[model samples]
Target: MGRTIFLLISVVLVAYYVYIPLPDAIEEPWTIGRKAAIVKIGTDLASFGELLGISHFMETMQLLMKFQEVPPTSDENVTVMETNFNSIPVRIYIPKRKSMTRRRGLFYIHGGGWCLGSAALLTYDTLSRWTAHKLDAVVVSTDYGLAPKHHFPRQFEDVYRSLRWFLQEDVLEKYGVDPKRVGVSGDSSGGNLAAAVTQQLIQDPDVKIKLKVQALIYPALQALDTNVPSYQEGSHFPMLTRSLMVRFWSEYFTTDQGLEKAMLLNEHVPMESSHLLQFVNWSSLLPERYKKSHIYKNPTPGSSELAQKYPGFIDVKACPLLANDNILRQLPLTYIITCQYDVLRDDGLMYVKRLQNVGVHVTHHHIEDGFHGAFAFPGLRLSERMQNQYLSWLIKNL
Candidate 1:
C-alpha cells in the first residue's frame, strides 16, 4: 500500500512537471532566467503543498508567502498613523512639509488576489509613502478582510466606506488637502477595489467631494470574461497562472468549490447578462495592438445561473468594466498601467477604451516587457521606471 501510494504521487508529480503551462515564446535571456527562477521556486512551493496533502490553494498560497520579509514600518519624511475609517482598519500617511497649496489626498488599497495581504510598508507601502512625499499628499491605505472568511462586496464595502469617509469628512481641510485633487489608486487586487469604488461613487449625490482621478495599476477589473486574449497569452506565465486566477476569484466570490473550475470558462456570467457583454467584449473593444491571432467565443448560454445565484458580478458597483454610460460618462480622469506579461492586461486596456469611448480622459502607460505585479516588484528595472512615471503623472494631474 505504501509503494502504491508513492507511485501514484510520483505519476501525478511527473504529469504536472511535464505539462506545466509555460510561456513558449519568451526569447530574452534575462526574462528566461527570471521566469525560470520564478517557476522553480513556485514549483517547489506548489509541490510542497501537494506532498503535504494541502488541497486548498489559498492556504497553500498563504504558506508560500512566508518566504518574504515584513518591511520596516516607518518613513522619515512622512508621519504614519493607524486609524479606522468607520469600523474598517486604515493607516494614514502625512508628509512633514506643509504645502502652500492644499495637497492632494490619495487612498491606496493593497493587492494580493484578494486572498492575503496588508497595508504594510513592504507589500505596497513603499510606493504610497513615495507618493505622499513626492506629491506631498495624504495617503490612506486600507485593510480589508481575507477570503473564504470574508467574500465579495465585503472588501468592496470596506473600500467604499473608506472612500465615503474621505468624501464626507472635512479630511481635505484637516489634512491640508485639495478637495478637487483627490483620487484613489491600488495595485492588482487593490486596483480591482479602486476601480469598483470609482464606479460606485458616480451615483452618490451625497458625496461631498468628487474624486478627480483614478489610477489603476494592472487591476483585475472583471470576472465575467476569463477567456480574453490576455488570459490565453499570459495564462501560463510566471507568478500568475490561469487556473490560479480562477481559484483566486472563486475563493473570494463563491464557497461552492465545485463551481470554481467551471467559472474559469466564464460560467459565472448568466445568459440574462448577455446584454451586458457588449460593454466588456475584448475582441471588438480592445485596441488593435492588444489583438493577437485568437479565437473568440460568445459567452456560452446558461452562464447566468451563477449571476442569478450570486448577483454581485452583474452589478456595476462590483465590476466597473460593465458600468453603464451614465456612470462611465461621469467618471473622473483615469490613469491606467498595463503589463505585457500579466493575465489582466487586456482588462485594463479594454477599460481604457471604455472610459475613452464615454468621453472620459485617460492616461495609459503600457510596459512592453513588464509582468502583472511589477508595481510592487522591486527587481524589475522597467517596473521601477514605470512606477516613477506613474507618480510623475499623478504629480502633473494633481
Candidate 2:
C-alpha cells in the first residue's frame, strides 16, 4: 500500500508538469511542433530529451539531421572540387540535359548563423543539386570557415576571395556558363553573405564581373535591432530564438570583449557616425502594416560601464545591413524569401524596402505557413509540403 501511494504521487507530478503552459512567445503551434520534433529526435539519439536544448550548437545539429532522406535526381550531375581561395572547399552541380548554349551559374552559400554549418550539409547539397536540375543552371556551393575561431572579417573575406577566384579561373567559360547569367544565392546566414558579396562586387571599381541577380532566403540582413516585430513574436521559435541569436553574434565577433560591445551595438560602430541612422529609421523601413502587432518600445540605454567592457558589437561588418546607401544602391536585382513564422522574417522585409527605396529591383515572397528552418527538411514526411513550396518558389524565381 505504501509503494502504491508513492507511485500515484509520482504520476500526478509528471501529469502536472506535462500540462503546464509554455511561455507566451513559445506558444505558437508551429513552435510547439518544432520543439517536439527536436525533442523526439534527441530522445531517439541519446535517450534524453534534455539534449535537445535550443543553443546554437544543438540547433545546428538538429537542422543538419532534420531531412534524413534526399532522393537523388538523375538530371543533375555533381562534382567536388578544391578551389584556390585559401584552399576553400567547393561543390559544383550542373544540369545533365544536353544543350549547345551556355547556362546560368549560381554560387550557393549554406546558412548556420556563421558558426556551425558547411556546404556539404545534406540539406544544402540536395537543394543545390535540385536547383541545378530544376533551373538548368550550374550551382557552386562554397564551404566558408566558421566563426568563434575564425570570426568576423574572416568569414566575409573567405567568401569574397572564393568569388574572386571563381571569376579569375574563367569558371564561366570552363563550365559552359554565360558570364552575363552569373548570380549568387543563399538562405539565412548564407543570404546575408550573398547580399554582402553582391554589394562588395558592385562597389569594386576594378572588377568587371557582372551579376544577374541575388536570391536571399530568410536572410538575417541586419543585426542593428533585436526588437523587430518578427524577433519579438517568434523569439522562441525552435532552431532559432532571440537569446541564441545574441549568442551567435557574440561568437562571430570573436573576442571576450566583443560580447559587451555587441549588446550595446557599439563594438565597431562609433556612436557619432552617421551610419547609426540606418537602424533608427523605424517608420520608413518597417511597414506600419507589419508593425501592427508589435509594441514599439525604446531601447533601454546601456550602462556606461558595460559599454566600455565590450566594443566589438558596433562594427558595421558584423551587421552588413547597417552598410551605407552608397553600397546598398549597388546591389543587383534581388529575390528575397520571408517566412511568416520566422524570427528573421522582418530582417528580409526591411531589406526589401531599403533596396526598393534605393531603386534596386526586388522580388519578394512571403511564406505564411512556414516556420524557421522549414527548408532544411524538404524530404521529411511531415514537412514535405512546406519544403516543396519553398523550393518551388526558388525554382520559379531562379
Candidate 3:
C-alpha cells in the first residue's frame, strides 16, 4: 500500500511538470536557464496546489514570490523607514545627504499583478534606496494589500491614499521633499496604478502639488485586445505568460476565475462600450515596425452577460490606455519602457502614440532584447541597465 501511494505521488508530480513545459523561445538569453527554470517551477507548484484543491493558484503563487523577500538592512547612503500613511503601509527611503535645499521626491510602486510583491521585497526596497541615494531624492514605496483577498479599487485606493498623504504640505516639509518636483513611477500592475493615479491627479482640485514626470517600465496598460502583436509573439514566454497575466487581471477585480478564459478571448468589454475599442485599436495605432506580419482582427462584440458579471474588466481604472484625450494631454513628461519579448510591449507603444498625438512630451524606450519583469531580477546586467535608464531620466527631469 505504501509503495502504491509513493508511486501515485510520483506519477502526479511527473504529470504536473509535464503539463507546464518551458517555452523553447526564450528571448532573454542572458539568464534563460535560471529564468525558465524558476518560472516553470513556480507555475507548476502553484498549478499543482490548485489541482489538489489545497489553495487557489493566485495565493500559492503569491506565497512563493513573497518567500524570496529579504528583510531590510542598514544602508550607508540611505536611511530606510517602514511606516504607514493613511493606514496604507509604506517604506520611505531618505538619502543621507545634508542638502541646503529640498530634494526631489518619487512615489515608487512595486508590481506583481496586484496580488503579489510588496515594498518590503528586496527588489523594490533596493530600487527605492538607490533612487534616493543616487538621485539624492526621497522615495516612498507603497505596500498596498494584495488582491483575491482585498479585490479591486482597494489596491488603487491604498496607493491613492498613500500618495495623498505623501503629497500633503506637512509631510513634504517634514521629509524635505520638493513638492513641485515630485514624480511617480512603477512596474507592471504598479505601472497601471501609477498611470491611473497620475490621470486622476490631473483633475484633482484639492491637491495643489503637480507631478513632474512618470516612468512606466513595461507596464500592462490594457485589458482589451490581448490579440496585439506582442501578445501573439511573446505570450508563451516564461516569467509572465499571457494566461498568468489575464488571470491576474481577472483576480484583481473579482473572485471569479471563470472570467479569465473569456477575458483572454477579448469578450470582457461590454457591447455598449464597443466605441472605446477605437482608442485601443492597435492595428491603427501601432507603428509599422510593431505590426510586423500579423493581421489585425477587430475583437468580437463584447458579451453583455460577461460585462454585467464582471464590469471592472472594461473600467478605465483597469486600463489607463482608455483614458480620454484631454486627460492624456495634461499628463506630465512621461518615460515609458517597452520590451520586445513582453506581452505588454504594444500597450506601451500604443500609449506613446496616444500621448504624442495629444502633444504630451514622451520619452519612449523600446528594448528589443528585454522581457516582462526585467527589472525584477536585480544584479543582472539587463536589470541594471533598465534601472539606470530609469534613474537617468529622473535625474534629468526632476
Candidate 4:
C-alpha cells in the first residue's frame, strides 16, 4: 500500500509539472517593447474559468495562498500611526531613524486595479515601510474603498480627501517630515490616483503644496485606447492585462450602468476635441520615435444612443494623459518606472513624453527583464532580481 501511494504521488507530480502547462508566451528578455503582449495574456488568463465574477474572492484567495511569501519583517525603527479620512482608514509609516534631521513625505496609494487593494495588503505594507526606512521618509498609505462597491469618483475622492487632510493637518510634523519636500507615489491604479492628485493640486488655489517629486510605477494613466501597441503586444502577461483592466473599470462604474456601451464604442472621448489632438501630436506629447511602431486606425463609430448614455467614458478626468497642456505644465519633477512585460507601458511612455513636452523634469526607468506586479512580489524566490532592482531604484532616487 505504501509503495502504491508513493507511485501515485510521483505520477501526480509529473502530471502537474509536464501536462498542466505553465503560463506560456511569457516574453523572453522582458522589456518595455513587449508590454502589450504580456498584459493581454495576463488579462485573458485572469478572465478564464468564470473568474471575472469572483475577482474579489479570487484576489483574497491569492493573498491567503501567499502566506509563505509574507513572512514578518522587522520594522523596529518604524512607527505606524493610523488615521481617518472622511471615515476611511489611513496608515502612516514613520521611520525612527536617529541620524535623520529632516525627511521627505510620501503619500502612497496602493495598486490593486482600484477595485481590490487595501493598505493592509501585506506586500503594500512591506513596501511602504521599506520605502520609509530606505529613504528616511514618512510614508502614508491610504486604505481607499474598492470598486463595484465604492465606484469611480469615490476612490478618487477618498484619495484626494486623504491628501488634503495630510496637508491641512500638518500630519507630516507627527512623522518628523518637512512639508515642502512632500511627494506622491503609487503602483498601477494607485499610480493613476497619484498622477491625478498631482494634476488636481496643480489647479487648486487653497493647496499651495509644491510636490518635489512624483514616483509612478506601472501607472494606469490612460483609458482612451487600450489598442495601443503595448496593449496589443503584452495583453497576456501573467499578472495584468487589458481585459482585466477593462473589467476593473467596469466594476468601478457598476453604478453607472451604461459603461459597457461607452467602452465598446470608444465614444468616451470626443473626436474633434483638442484633447484628442494633443494625444496624436507627435512633436509635442508623443515623439516620432516612440510612434514608430504605432498603427493608428479610425475607430468604428458607436450608436448615438450609446454615446449619449456613456459620456463619462471619454472624459479627460478618466484618462489623465488626455488632460490639457495647462495642467501638464504644472507637474513637478517626475520619476516613472515601466515594466516591459506589463500592458500599461505605453501609457507611461506617452505620459512621459507629454511631461517632457511641457518642459517638466522627468526621470524614466524601463525594467527590461521585469513583469507587472514584480515589485510587490519581492518575497517570491523567482522575483528577487526584479524586486532588488526596484528597491535599489527607490532608495537611490527617493
Task: List lDDT for all candidates, in order.
Answer: 0.78, 0.67, 0.85, 0.68
Worst 10 residues of 2 by lDDT: 18-27
lDDT of 3: 0.85
Per-residue C-alpha lDDT of model 1 across residues 1-398, encoded as one tens digit per residue? 99999999999866654444444342343544554466556656865776788745566655566555354366679987778888888888899886688888999898888887788646566767787888889998888887767888788998899778877557667877788888999988889899998887877787868898899999988877788988888887767778777777777776776557666767666666778888779878888867767867876754546666667666766678888787888888899999888898988999999888889999999887777676776565665688899989998886
Model 4 segments beyond 4 Å from truth?
1-74, 255-258, 261-277, 280-294, 303-310, 380-398
Which candidate number maximizes lDDT?
3
Model 3 per-residue lDDT tens digits across residues 37-96: 677888788899999999988899888887777676658899888888999988898988
lDDT of 2 by residue, 305-395 (tens): 4334433345555556776777888777788888777878888888888888888888777777665676665444425554555456546
Candidates in order, TM-scores: namely 0.87, 0.78, 0.93, 0.78
Better of 1 and 3 by lDDT: 3
**Candidate structures ordered by TM-score, highest first:** 3, 1, 4, 2
lDDT of 4: 0.68
| Global fold similarity of model 4 (TM-score) | 0.78
Candidate 3 — worst ten consecutive residues by lDDT sum?
A: 19-28
Question: Which is the winner by TM-score between candidate 3 and candidate 4?
Answer: 3
